[model samples]
Target chain A: MSTSEGGDSPGEAGGGPDGTGDSGGLRTTLTRTRAATALTLRRRDSLSVVTGVTVIYLLGYLWAVGDLAPGFGGYGLVLAADPLGGLLRTTSGPLSFAPVALVRAGPLAYEASLNTLVGLGLALLVGLNLGLTYLTRKQPAACGLRSSTGVLAGVPALLSGTACCGPVVLVALGLQASGVILTAFQVLLPAAVLVLVGSLVAVGRQVRPEAMAAASGSGARGSDNRE
Target chain B: MPRLTRRRTLASLASLGAAALAGCTTDANTGGGGGTVPAADDRLPLPIEPPALRDAAVSGGPGKDGIPSIDEPSFVAPAEVDFLADGDPVFGVARDGVTKAYPQSILAQHEIVNDELAGDPVSVTYCPLTGTVLGFDRGATSFGVSGRLVNDNLIMYDRATETWWPQILATAVPGPWNAEPETRSLREFRLVWTTWERWRGQHPETRVLSRDTGSPRNYARDPYGDYNPREGYYAGGAPLFPPLREDDRYGPKRVVMGARAPEGAVAFLKDGLREAGLLSGQLGDVPVLAVHDPRYDTGYVYRNPDELAYESVDEGVEGPAGITYAPDRLPLDRIHTFDAMWFAWAGFYPETDVYE
Candidate 1:
């Protein structure tokens, strides 16, 4: 998959363990980076997931905060049944009047701030997972499997609704705060980001290209160029 | 009831916001204490006598302060409040040379300002429903609305004690401290309910409260109605909530200069004060004076430190005893007076005497 300079110059770059068939080292790395970057941008399924969460949160947030702040007044994405009514009821604003009632309602800002943060975090976390496979195409089967599993493990955290002050609320709820949701947020976000970054490292380390093996051996009685 | 530890007690108080304290203990009501305000326990004194409280059917609405009290109130130079109409009523207070005005137009939205005036902490409060504007020296504790109302008046709670202070009664009604032996009521300043133009014109360097309160509100418009034309809510004397006691000597919401003392309570009709800047009367043997300060457009009630006034000033004749005097020329000994709607005053002070 590498269109690296090693494909042309051959000897100047380091070679892979696959002998002459290995794509050149630095060239393979650049190829991997471009592939990963492109894959991240092109993943339609992943993009839809991020976009979906954003749209849903925006619609729900607008409906819940309706007519509270001066600019935030009015229905959004009109769901006739007002699916977010339960969310709105949970809010403390007056339901009848628009702006005034919104003023009277409590926690509209708090909820909105937290909900938007959670939605965006989900978008970034999901995007990282989708970008991993193309960046680690040297062992496509293994990397793709890891990416799928990591994303599945993460989906629950995004859905848990603990994205904002959920942990504080969880602590407040004590036994009632879902332990699984708490663990997912506390552990999964970082783990997912790390896993995605680790795939890039694997590409650089394992996906070496051919040709350079015979040439620049850190030279000096070296039996093999790479340990 | 479950045993409540300090932790549990403190934890329980997390639910009440500063604004919620305004509605508590009404014809009385109830709620969550949150940390700053202790939960109302049996320890509070039963300071208010019966008839001082009545259930106001329509619970207190978050009159702009639902976002909560302005623990930190911001103020600007009097000239900054250029939008104020000359007739827009304001609650003006001058303490230790510090003169400040709280415009009804602005306060109608916020309802309470928990701030420090001079060196003493103060809470400038207004209840549009009750049509009352008053000020309190918080001592050290701040007041938050418990979101409860008694007799259509705002019930405020102290951050230290969730003890309910119904706006008109100024007495801690219920909660943990209600049964304590001594009734604790803070001294309220006599906030002159006058116009901003009149207040600023008189106190040229006075500072006016800025409407930039963090809370969201339409400061220019009054939720109850406009006071300039004296229409809408003020049009007729109608109580939003049924009073504990019904007294029709005057319309339910008639404007009056109301006062409270260790001795008793009395309300003077604004009509008499409008004509005579000074009107002296006796309630339960205590000679009092109600002086109208036209500059602030507020009527003041004073305890006649002048003992001879009862005999010297005309006692029975309505107009004869009202010695002509400027509102500013009031005697040194002054009593705290709050301008209130008759319905709220009557409801809280049912045994209160009517001074026409």
Candidate 2:
């Protein structure tokens, strides 16, 4: 049962019943592979969770921004006369489904549009961070990622801050994401517990020699797992 | 799964309920209390006692009109007139002819006077609401300056004793056009006389005439009479045998009416008119006399002490709102008062109608 680095070679410790290393180093690599596999799965799961959560957070943030639009003096007339008007006009085609034109029509419309955009942006950022935490039990790692993402998201947030609540939502979403990811696991005690329990169960199943053997027996399990 | 713990389940339910309750409570209360508060009535300081008819004996033969006459009525004598010392007299007199016989003793005490005389632009005026009789000149300017200019429509006159009586312009003498026609010619000058008894109701000061009264005669004289040739002369501009100098004080000077009076004097005048049966129903659609004095033109009609109501007009070409008088289109039939102190005998012939 000789093992090869990178765990791709066959005939490692406790290899599959074929006697040839056709199963690769899966069995012998189970110990180290479990952690690595679990981490890879977690990262992928985090990406999906983050993307979904970010979308939801962005939606909420945009809604909040729109709700607070009128108070910020971002009426349609003001926006149209503003320097950003041209930029907004250019982007209007892409956001045609959104009520961007309606927003530019009147103060209330502008506020509503801004709020929606901000809410959607915030939801996306927050949702992504939450999804990431759900996928990976490493909250510290998620937090570091959130901080870096926040700096990137902050640029848009600042630009839109003066623009009817849109930027505010972005900033809020970024802040929420950073808060969720950077804070200690105990800080998000409930969510951290859920992620820890889920990851443990998943990794436990993967580390099992019998389960690994079964999983490799038909490559179908691996494919299914990947999907 | 084993049986769930009751305590843990109950705790979880409580926490969930608390969170829901927290979200529901967001609004708070904000504003002040409600109560009734009365306004304060501040009185101007003057040395004179309020005006009143003396209870003493009435002397001297009655004049041509049968009203008791006081000869050589001294208005403001050196010994009698004391602006600081005397309690002013506020008295009423009916205009019989060209001569206005003011009980000098009454005027001497009060020093200030408020009266309604037949003149163009019948005015209700205050002479010294500010305690100073600073003359205003309305000569070549827009609003012709003539007749009487008083401060706050309160008049004070001292007759014999130095004590002056403050006459308050309480109510306006209803003009001919007012709804109450019967009360039009009523001669009872509607004014508020602040008596000692009445004074004591609000103030706890002694009711006595001070001996230090004075007058601001040095102030510029109201120059309206200077522009008019007939004010100080005989009838129809016939210069009397003796050409009168501008300083010849013998003739009719622009007399000030309704200057300063005691506090609430205006209210008292209203009540007096009601008691005298002078005011009836509502004041009719009387055309307001709007005077535009450019010198002091703050774009509003200066409320005549005798005027019941007033509002300021704008200065520019727009003129003012509710101004029914147009100098170019002078309506003769309408008996209108000029914003200036002079009264316009609207329908009366300008040649025969004698006005001071």
The per-prediction tally of clashing pairs is 49, 111
Regions of candidate 2 where Cα sits further than 4 Å from its true position: A1-48, A67-99, A103-122, A138-227, B1-356
- For model 1 the local lDDT of residue A179 reads 37
lDDT, residue B301, model 1 = 71
lDDT (Cα, tens digit) per residue for candidate 2, span A132-160: 33432333221111223322333343233
Instruction: Quote model 1's TM-score.
Output: 0.52
User: Candidate 1, which CAPRI tier?
Assistant: incorrect
Candidate 2 is graded, for docking, as incorrect
Per-residue alpha-carbon lDDT of candidate 1 for residues B1-356, written as tens digits (9 for 90 to 100): 11111111211111221122443322212222432322221221122342233223223433222325667788999767665787888888888999998888777655779888888777888877788877876655677766556776777767665566776666555543343312334456667787877887888999888866643344544545678878666666455545656777778768878775545566787876766656666533467777665555567776764543421222222223565445545443566677788877766555555566
Q: DockQ score of candidate 2?
A: 0.00
Per-residue CA lDDT of candidate 1, range A1-227, in tens? Answer: 23343233222223533234345555554554444443434444434544554555444433332222222222322221233432322111232121212132323222232234434454444444433432233233322223234345445434333322323223223322233654554454345445544544443233232212222223212433221
